[model samples]
Every structure is written in C-alpha cells, then in structure tokens.
Target: MQKLDRAWLDRHPLPSPAIGGDKNARGRVLVVGGAEFVPGALRLTGEAVLRAGAGKLQMATVRAAAMSLAVLMPEAAMIALPADDDGEIASGAIELLGERLANCDTLVLGPGMSASERTEQLVAALLRGASAGQTIVLDAAALTCAGNLGTLVAAHEGRVIMTPHYGEMAYLTGIDAETIANDPVAAAERVAEKFNAIVVLKGARTVLAGAGEEAALFEGGSAGLATSGSGDVLAGVIGGIAARGAVPFTAAGWGVFIHGAAGEHAAKEIAEIGFLARDLLPAIPKLIANFGAG
Candidate 1:
C-alpha cells in the first residue's frame, strides 16, 4: 500500500484551469441527491464542488424541496426531479436528467438518499444513461447497488468511484463491519476489483483501492469529520476534482487528502469534536491553494 499524503500527492497534481478560463472551461458537475428531509445535502455538496474548483454546478433533487434548496444555494442551477410517495427521487426521473447527465463532466449521486430497492433501480438507470466519458461518483445509498452492478460499473473503465464508510462497505461486500475494519485495504480492494471501480473505504484510516492498482491509505482526518453529512462533503469534493479533469484515482486521492486536511483545519478553528459538516467547506478552497493545486 502507498501512503496518500502530501508527498505522494505532490508528484501527481490535479489539472489546473487556464488563466482566462470561463466557468464552463473549469468543468460541470451534476449532483443528484437530497430528499424532502435532507435537502440541505445538495447545497453542501454543490458548494463543495465549486470550492474544489469545478466551474459550474447543477443540483437535482426531489421536487418538493427544489425551490427552497435553490434559494439556499443560488450558485447552482437547480433541477427538480420527480419524487416518489416517500420523497425519494423516483426512478422515472432519469428522463428529466438525460440532457444534464450527458452534459456534465461528473455525476455525484446518492448523498442523503434512502437505501431501498427503488434507489437501486434509480442508480442502475442513471448508470446506464450516463455517457461513456462521464465520471460517476457514488456515495451513501448508491454504494449499496455495487453487488448487483456487475458490468455496469466495469463498463466505465476507471471512471466510477464509490465512497463508503464501514457500514456501507460491509453492505457492499456482504462482510460484517467488524471484519472489514480489521483489514480495510483488502475490503476496499475486493470491491474495487469486483466492480472495476475505484473504491474509497472511508474510516479513521481511509483506504482507496482501484482495480489492478496499488492501494493508497490516508489517516489524517479529524474525529469531528464523524459528524452528520461529512461523507456527503467528501463525495462532493471527489466529484468536483474529477470534473476538473483529474483521473478517477488521482481525484479520489486528492479528495481524501483535502477532506482530511480540511477537517484538521476545522478542528483547530472550532471544537475538535463539535464542528458541523458545513464548517469544513470554508477550508477547502484554501487547502487546495495551499497545496498549489486547483
């Protein structure tokens, strides 16, 4: 395993924007997340995308919460997806996302979404609809569909990345969380190879494994990152980096390092264990600049 710290990252820098680049020149990211109860998730994610240096942002969420979330996050162009009875994005909403999905450089899915067969169907449909060149960043409930995706993710080559904490990792591999915690690298590798997607196993020592690639481990994020919606921020960070033209593996590595570093920054400014997920956002752009990256 390789350590995914500053030294390793310095040698593999992310692509920088041109001096006179426009918003579209940076990259476009489409974030499909949030339900009626968790509309703030899209705002957190969309903002993180911009902070990570992605150019344009589009937030797609349940229709019921779209108007309010749009007001909360005026930077992103909002798309209201049809909702099911439970306020989850309906599977049929893919019809509405077709053009956006095709235009986006990266698609960040599954944040704040409920885990259910319906979500799985939605995941599968979106995966199928995504263009060959689009990067897919799957988090939260979207990771649950891995076991059944088979060729769906593999078809993306190295473009699909999944971020899963211990419980979500266990669910993806059918291994108990305890067993996965014992050897997170191996757990991450198993899923990475099985799906042919980059696997980011998030924990105290996050393990990033890609199919046929060396595992990269990071162990520097603050405990405060354990708060609610933290993973959503991490997912958005990765998506934004990917949208900016970083390869999937490079994007995942940078995202992990930046997120952990951001948590440390937040811990110093706020309480080490009491900082909310939103507190980490302000530190992201500064962190990337400090690294001489985008």
Candidate 2:
C-alpha cells in the first residue's frame, strides 16, 4: 500500500457551490428508525442532517416517537406510523413509509430502531428500491437487524454504506470483536467487499472503503463521543451529506471527520466518561465552521 499524503485528502472537499435551487434539489434525506423506547434517534438524527447541510430531513418513526421528536426537533419533518405494543413498527407502516420514501434522494437507516418484523420488512423494501441515483447509509440496530445483508446488497442498484462499531461489525461480518478492534481497517475492507457495500467501520480511527478502493482511515474525534446518541448523530451527518448530492464515499469521509470534530469539542467541557450525545450539538456548529460551511 502507498503512504497516504495530504494531497490525497485535499481531493475530498465538501459540496459544490449552491446555485439557485429548490430545497428538494439540494436533497431530501429520509431516515428510517426510532421506536417507542428510543426517542433520541429521531431528534439526534434529524439535527445531524441539518448540521451536515442537508436541505430537508424526514424521519419515519413510530407515531408516539414521531410526535415527541416533532416537538423536540421542529426543523425535522416527522412521518408517524402505527406501531405494536412495544413501540415496534408493524407491517402496516411499510405502505405508508413507501409512499414518502419515493421522494427521498437518500436514506439513513437503523438509528434507534427496534427489531420488529415490520421494521425488517421495511428495510428489505428500501434495499430493493434503492437505485443508482439514490444513496443509502446503514448504522446501529439496522446492521444486526438483517443479519444477512446479501439480499439488501443484491437488491440495491446503487451503493450501500454500512457503519458498524466493533461489536456490531463482528455480528454483521462474523468476525470477533477482538480481531476487529485490532485491525479495523482490514476488517472493514474485507467485509465491505463480501457484501459489495461501502463500509465505514467506526472507532477511534474510522475507515471507509468502496468503488474498488481498499481503505481511507480518518483519525478524528474524542472519546467523549462514546455516548448513546452520538452514533445516531453520525448517521444523520452522513445521510445529510448524501442528500446534498455527495456520493456515499464522500459523505462518509465528511461524516467521519465532522462526527469526531463534534466529539472533540464536547470533550473539553465534560469528561469523556459522562459526555452525552446532546453535548455534541454546540460543537457541531464549531466543527462545520472548520469546514468553512458556516
């Protein structure tokens, strides 16, 4: 492998100049996840997309959660769906979700989703419908929900970007946590090829791979980001980038950089052990400023 240089990174910049365009033209990103038990996903994800520069972000979640998220995140559009007793989505919701999904340019799945049969069915349908023009990013619970991702990969015409922590990586890739922890780049690249999906293996140093390229490792962020809602925020960032017309690999690169930058800021005020996902909010603006987006 050749040594990575500064010029290599200078190549991957942010979105092209924003010409006169409609909000939908900027990008409409749909995030599919959240449950009765998990309201954090909806709020964090929606906010992250906005912070990452997406023009529109729509979150499809259980009705109750959607209501809560709407109140918490006024900027994010919420689509409510009926759910089971445990707040898990039911099959009936799929049809309603499908209608709205047709308008979305990108998808961000499994932030705070609960594993219900209905949720699984919804994911499968999205994968089937995902075409070359549309971009998709998978994270958190969605990684394990399918267990076998072959169908999703085979179904999607465009590329799929899957982000997994070490444990989730092991579960999805059938590798052990210890091995993934040691050689995350190699592990991410290997499994990405097997599934034929772009992989963003998350950790202290995030690794991205796709389009015949082997790997791009980004070391950014602080341990303070080890909070619950942080991953959801990261997913939103990538989804937002996708909505902005950036491809999967470029979005992942920016997402990884910004996610860590937010965490880095959050760590200054709070200890790494106790920092929460919300802590990264203020940091997000500062981070984006670094990108000259603000």
Candidate 3:
C-alpha cells in the first residue's frame, strides 16, 4: 500500500475556482439521508461538504427533520422525503429523489439514516436510478441497508464509493471485524475488487482501495476523530471533492488526509479527549488554505 503523505496531498490539490465562475462552477452536491432521531448526522455532513468547497448543496432528508436541518444549514437547499410512521424515510420517497438526482454532481447516501427494510428499498431505488458520471458516496446505514452491495455497485459502473468502519466492513464482506482489523488494506482491497467500487475502510489509519488501483493508507488523525458524526464529516468532505470533479479514489484519498489533518488541528486546540465532531468543521477551511498556500 502507498502512504498518503503531505507531499502527495500537496501534489493533488483540490480544483481551483475560476475568476468569473459562478457557484455551479465549483460543483453541486446532494446529500440524501437523515432521520428524525438523528437529525444532526446529515447536518454535520452538509456543513462539512460546504466547508470542503462544494459550490451548491442540497439535502434530502425525512420530513420531520427537514425544517430543523434547514435551519441548521441554511446554505443547503432542503428536500423533504415522505416518512413512515416510525419517522424513517419511506420507500415512496424514491420518486421525489429521482426528480432531483440529475441536478447534483455527487450524491452522498446513508448518513443519519435508519437501517430497515424501507431504507434498503430506498437505497436500491436510488442505486438503480443514479445516472452515469454522477459520483455516489455511501456511508453509515446505507452500507448496511443494501442486500446485495456488489451487484448494486457493479450496476453503477464503478461510480460508487463506500465508507465503512470495521463493523460495517464485516457486515458487507462477511469477514469478522477482528479479521478486518488485523489487515485492513487486504480487506478493503478485496471488497473493492468484489464490488468494483472504491472502498474506504476507516480506522485509526484509514485504508482506501478500488478496482484496478493500488491500495493507499493514511495515518494522521487523532482520537478526536473517533467521536460521533466524525465519519459523516469525512463522507461529506469526500462527496464535496467528488462533486467538484475528483475521481472516487482521489476524493477518498484527499478526504482521508483532510479529515486527519483537521482532527490534529482540533486536538491541538481543545485537546483530543474533549473535542467534538463539530469542532472539525472550522478547521477544514484553514487546512485547505494551508494546502493552497503550500
């Protein structure tokens, strides 16, 4: 596996904005997922994507969480999905999402969503409906909801990127968490080859792999990144980068580095133990600025 060092990151800078370009020039991103009970998850993700330089943002969430999430993230246009009695996004919401899918350059799925049969149905529908050339970043419950991830990802023609922690990776690959933890690069690469999509197996040192590409590893984040909603932030950063035209593997690599760098910044300020996930948001722009400066 190749190590993602500062030099490598500096070489792969994010797309620079044009002098007279409008918001659309940076790229449009749609984040789809958020339940009533976990409204903060998608909100964190949305904010992270904006901070990571996505030009326009849209959020598609459950009806109950829509208004509040909109208030939390005024920058993103909000789309309320139909909800079932349990406050989960209903299967029927697929039609509403289909109407908006073509408008976005990137689709971020699964943050803050509940894992259920309904969620599986929704994921399946979205996967089937996703257009060619649109990037898909899957995280949290979306990873678990898919009944046949390989088939779904293959159907997308390798445009999908999945972010799974050890446990989620176990569920997706049927490899026990312990085995995955022992050698994450191998596990991530195997899953990447099987699914024909980019696989980001998140941990202390994240591993990234995709079909026909060399595996890469990043080791820089602090324990501050272990907090809740942190993975959502990572997903958002990657989605934003992908929306701005980075390929799946490049987006994942850059996202992993930026997340780890932001974690280090947050840890230095608040100390690793007490820093919250939101603390990482403010650090993102500064890191990007430093990248630009270098």
Candidate 4:
C-alpha cells in the first residue's frame, strides 16, 4: 500500500457544476440491491445518490419491495425485479438490470442484499458485463461475494470501488483488523491492486487507492456515520459522484468527504445517536457547498 497524507485531499476538491446544461450531462445511477426484509437499503441508496447530485436515480429491486419503495421513495424511479418463489431476485433480474445499466453511468450494488442464489447470479453477470469507464461501487455482501478478487479486476479495471470496514476487509484479505488498523494504507492498496479497482477502506480516516497514484487519506467526520445503513449511504454517494464521470480515486475521495461532513452537520441538530443514516440527507448540499468542492 502506498503511503498518503491529508495534504493530498486539501489539494484536490471535487469538480463543480457536476453536470452541464443537459440531462445526459449529469450522470445517471442504477442502484441494485434490496430483498424481502432489507428493501430499505435500496431506498436509502436511491435517496443518498440523488442527495449527492445524481440527476437521475433508479432502484432495481425484487418485485416484492418495489411498491413500498415507490411510495416511500418517490424520488427514485423504481425498476421492478422478477422474483423467484422465495421473494428474492431471480436470474431474470439480470435482464432487468442489464437494461437499466445500458442507460446508467454507474452501478451501486449489494446494499441490502442477501446471498441468495439469484442475487449471486445477477451480481456475477454484472461483474462480467461491466466495462471500462462505467463505475461499479460494490458494498457489503457483493464485495465479499467476489471471492476471487483478481478476476473481478480483470473483468473491469479501474471501475470497481470496494467499501469495506475492518471486519469485511479482514474476511476478504485474511488480515486481522489490528494489523490493518496499524497500516490501513497497505491493506487498502493490496486489495485495490489485487482487484484493479480503487478501494475506499472506510474507517477513522478513509484511504483511496487506484492505478499509479499513491493512496490519499481523507480525515474527517464522526462516529455518527457508524450506523446500520451508513455503508449503504456511502456506496450511493460514491456512485453519485461516479455518475459525474470523476476518476475512481477522486470520486471516492469526494464521497468520503461529503458523507463525513454530512454526518458531522447532521449530528449538530439530531444528536450523534439520534440521527439516522438517512438524516444525513439534508446536510449534503451545505456540505458540498461549504467544502469549496463545488
């Protein structure tokens, strides 16, 4: 892992006018996640993506959850997935996702998903179908499911962003959190190089890694972001920025800052524990503007 310090982030803020005067100019994000019991992941992701500046946000989820989410999250244009007997997405969901990905600039996968057979099928197909320049932010389960990290990178280089906390990172790399905690950059770079995608090793200081560039650590935010669905929100934020056509490392950096700053602001009124993951929504605009990242 490459050594990185805070100075690098102070130099590279996210670009402004995220999009031009047209709809296509602003990026579209397709978020694929949600199951019978965890449909909220899709809703949280869709909301977070839009809050972070994705012009158009689509939610692809099992048909069982579509109606509830459509009503709860009106902002998200929902794509109803074909489900199997267990109410989980079936292989047929891949076709629906493929159709959506054809029009989207990015994919945020595995937010509230279970390790169902069909879910695995759809995720595998996505890893196979994803191409260069199209960003894929794999969080939670999807990150772990792609067991053979090298093949994932070979499938699409510089297109994957794996957001893993200590446990997931330990599980994926066979390194304990203590070892990784002492040297997160090294762990981040090892996995990033293994998969050929930038890795956002989420923690006290988020580290970003990609091709050729030495890693950069973004230090900010608070424990308020350490909630249940916060990781899902982070994935959506990264996907939203990716929709803007920013490079993987830059996008991850911006996302880390945006989310952390949002958490910090949201905590002021909502109390660190009082505020939920979704509460970070209202803080996004000001956080973006205040950071001079615009």
Candidate 5:
C-alpha cells in the first residue's frame, strides 16, 4: 500500500493548462443524479466539478426538478430526464443521455439517488453506453448495479472509478460490511480487480485501489467529513479531475487527498463535527492551486 500525501502529489503533477485554450480545452463533465426530494445533492456535485477545475458542466436529473436546479446552478447546462413515480431518473433516460454521455470527458453518476429496480436498469444502461475514453465515476445507488455488471464495467478497461463507503462497498461486493471494514484495503483491491475499475473505499481511512496490487491510502480527513453530501463533493472532485485529463487512479488519489485535506482545513475553522458538506467546496480550488504552485 502507498500513502497518498502532498509529497506524493508533487511527484505526479496535474495536467498543465494550455497557453491559449478555451473552456472546451479544460474539458467537459456530465453529472447524472438527483431526485425531486434531493435535488440539492446533484447541485453540490455539479459545483464541485467546476471548483475542481473542469470548464464546462452538464447536469441531468429528474425533469420535475430541472428548472429549479438550473436556476440554482447557472453554470451547468441542464438535461431533464424522465422521472419515475418515485422521482428517480427513469430507465428511459439512457436514450436522452446517449449523446451527452458520448460527448462528456467524464461522467459522474449517482448523487441523491435511491435504490430500486428502475435505478438498477438506469445504472446498467448508462454503464454499458459510456464512451470508450470517457472517465466514469460511480457513487451511491449507481454502485448497487455495478457488481452484477462486471462485463459492462470492464468494457471501459481502467477508465472507470467507483466511490463507495463501507456499506456501499458491501453492497457492491456481497461481502459483509464487518469484513470489509476489517481490512478495507484488501476489500477495495478485491473489488477493483473484480470490476476492472479504480475503487475509492471511503471511510475514516479511505483506501483507493486499482486492478492488481495498486493501492493508495488517505487518513487525513476529520470527523467533519461524515456529514451528508460530503461523498457527493468527493465524487465531483474526482470526476472533475478526470475530466481535466488525469487518469482514473491519479484522479482518485488526488481527489481523496484533497477532500481529506479540506476536511482538516474545515475542522480548524469550524468545529470538527459541525461543518456542513458545502463548507469543503471553497477549500478545493485553494488546495489544488497550492499544489500547482509548488
């Protein structure tokens, strides 16, 4: 296992900006998530994507909430997907998202989504339809279907990344949460190999693993990061980084490190356990810029 730290980041710099490039040059990110009851979750993810340096953003969510979400997030171009009775994006969204999925440099899935058969179908279809080089970041309910669709995930080669907490990891791997928590690194590696994707096993001490023995560890975050929507921010950060040209493992390692560091920074300003998830957003660009400077 390797420690992911500032020194480690220095050795592996982010992609440098072009001398004269437009927003398109920075890359585009498409974030597909949110339900009527949890539209804010998708907004958080979309904002974090831009905060992490992706230039253009597209947010696809339940059609009912699209207009409101667009007003809340003016930076993102909104794509309203058909919604099921439960307000979840419907399986039919795959057709609406095909061109967007193909066009985006990175696709971030599952923030504020619920688990259901409809969700499973939507997730599977999206996973199967992602373009060859597009980076895919899966989190929350999107992960519930991943374990059953190994071939679809593996089709992307190493271009996919999954962020799952202990419970979510268990859901993806069919292992009990206790066993996974006992040795997360091993469990993360196992999942990564099984799906042929990079796995960010999030917890107090997050473990990022890719196919084979590759693994990186981050333990810098504080308890403040345990709040709701924090994982959404982390997913967006990773997706944005990937959109900007970092490989899956590189983006995961950096995203985990920055996220934890933001937690530590927030803890210093606010109480360790009281800071909101959105509090971590402002620190993101500052952290990235600091690394870019040195």
Candidate 6:
C-alpha cells in the first residue's frame, strides 16, 4: 500500500488542459440518482462536481425532485425520469437514461436513492448499458443495489469506481464491519479484485484499491466530514475529475485526498462541530488550485 501524500500528488497531478481550450475540453459529467425524500443529495453532488471543475453537468432524477433541483442548480441540464408511487425513479426509465449517458464522460450513480427492487433494477440496467469508455462512480444506494456485483462489473467494459462506507462495505462483501474496520486495505482490495473496479472504502482514513494497482491510503479528514451528504460530495469530486479525463484509479485517489483536505479546511474555518457538507464544496477549488494540476 502507498501513503497518499504531497509526494503522490506531485507524481500524479490533477488533470489540466491548455488555457486555450473551450469548456468541453475540461469534461462533461452526468449525475443520475435522487429520490423524493432526499432530493437534495443529487443537488449537493452536482454542485460539487461543478466546483471541482467539470465543464458540463447534467442531473437525471425522479420527476418529483426535478423542478426543485433544476431551480437549485440552473447550471446543470436536468432530466426528469418517470417515478413510481414512492417518487423513486422507475426501472422503465433505463432506455432514456442510456440514451443520455452516451454523451457523458462520467456517470455518478446513486445518491439518495431508495434501496428498493425498482432502484436495483435501474442500477443493473444502467450498468449493463453503459458504454465501454464511460467512467462510472457508484455510491450510496447503488452499492447495495448490485445483487451479483462481481458479475455485473465484469460484464461492463467501462471503468467502475465503488465508494462504500464500513456498513455498506460489509453489506457488499459479506465481511463484518469490525473486520473491515480493522483491515480496510484488505477488504477494499478484496472488493476491487472481485469486481474488477476501483474501490474507495470510505472512513476517517479512506482506502483506494484496484485489481492490479497498489492500494493507496488517504489520512487527513476531520469529524465534520462525518456529516450527512459528505460521501455524495466525494463522489462528485471523483466523478468530476474522471469527467475531465483522469482514469478511474487516478480520479479516486485524487478525490479522496482533495475531499479530506476540503473537510479539514471546512472544520478549521467553522470548527469541527458545526460544518455542513455544503461547506466543503467551496473548499474544493482552493485545494485543487494549491495542488497545481497539470
């Protein structure tokens, strides 16, 4: 395992384009997940992606949450997927979603989605339909939606990045939270190898692991990051970077480090006790600037 530090940042700097290129030169990201009850999750993630420097952003969410989310984030193009009685996106919306995803460089799936049969179906379909080059960042409810995660991921030709907290990690791998917490690197590695995807095992110190790559450990976040919606923001940061052309592994490593830095900055400014997830959004650009992307 490698320690994620300034040295690593120097080795793998963030992606940057020449000054003359247009917005599309940076990247395009599509975020697809939001339920009636927690519609704010996708909004938070979308805004974070823009703040992280994605050139274009699109949000596809349930019908009930569409208007408010569009109003909340006018910068993103919003697509309202048909919803079921519970206002969760319907499985039938997959056809339309697949069409929209064709143009996007990165897909951020499952933020604030309900863990229902419908949701699982939608996630499975989306995974099956994703293009070979699309970068998929699966988080929150999507982690629980994959019934045969290994088979599903292996079938897909695209790069898949899975972000799971200890509880979610336990659910995905059938490994107890206690065991994962004790040795997160091994747990993350197991998941990565099984799924043929990059795994971001989120915690106080996040672990980034992939099938054939060295595991990377990031170690500088604060208690403020324990707040709700934080992981969604991290997903956005990673998705945004991936949209900008960083490979899945690079994006995950950089995202973890940037997120931890932003959390620490937010905590320092507002004190660890009261910082919100949104507070970390604005801190992202500054951290990226300091890192000096190339």
TM-score of each: 0.98, 0.91, 0.96, 0.91, 0.97, 0.97
Q: Which 10-residue window in model 4 sums to the lowest lDDT?
A: 1-10
- Give the whole-model CA lDDT for all candidates, comma-separated: 0.90, 0.76, 0.87, 0.79, 0.90, 0.87
Give stretches of model 5 more than 4 Å off. none
Tens digits of per-residue lDDT for model 4 on 1-294?
323324444566665663235655768888988888787888778888887777888888888899999999887788998877766677877776777887888989889876655565677899777767788998877877765545855568677888989887897799999999999889988888777878889998888877566787767788788888888888988888888767778778878878887887887787866679888877776665666533
lDDT of 1 by residue, 1-294 (tens): 899988878877988778898988889999997898787888888888999999999999999999999998899999999999898998888789889899999999999898878888888888999988889999888878655786888899978999989998888888999999999999999999988999999999999999989999998989999999898899999999999999999999999999999999999998799999899999999898888552
lDDT accuracy of residue 31 in candidate 5? 95
* TM-score, model 4 to reference: 0.91
Residues 208-292, model 6: lDDT tens digits: 9988889988888898899899999999999998887888898888899899999889888999878889989988887988885
What TM-score does structure 1 among the candidates reach? 0.98
Q: Could you tell me which residue pairs clash in candidate 1?
A: none
lDDT of 1 at 152: 88
- What is the C-alpha lDDT profile of model 5 across 1-294, one tens digit per residue? 778888778866899877788988888999999999898999889999999999899999999999999999999999999998888888899899989988889999999898888888888888888778889998898877677788999899988899999998888878999999899998999889988999999999999899964588887999989999999999999999888889888898889988898899999999899999999999999999887676
Q: Which regions in candidate 4 have their CA more than 4 angstroms from the true location?
A: 1-10, 18-20
Could you give candidate 2's per-residue lDDT for residues 1-294 as a string of tens digits? 221223333566666737887777779988888888886677888888877778888888888777777888887788888888888776687778776778889888888886656666777877776666788888876766656657667455336888888888898778899988888878887877777778888877778876477578776678777778988888888888778877777777777777887777777777766788877766665565567433
**Candidate 6 wrong stretches, greater than 4 Å:** none
Give the distance in Å from residue 183's predicted Cα in candidate 2 to where it truly belongs. 2.0
**Per-residue lDDT over 1-294 for candidate 3, one digit per residue giving the tens place of the 0 to 100 score:** 688767767666667677788889888999999887887789889998999888999999988889988998899899998888988888889999887888889999999987898888888888888898899998988987763656977777668999999999999889999999999999999888888899999998899898998888888889878989999999999998888778788888888888999999888988987788888998887787686566
lDDT for position 44 in model 4: 76
Tell me the lDDT of model 4 at 93.
76
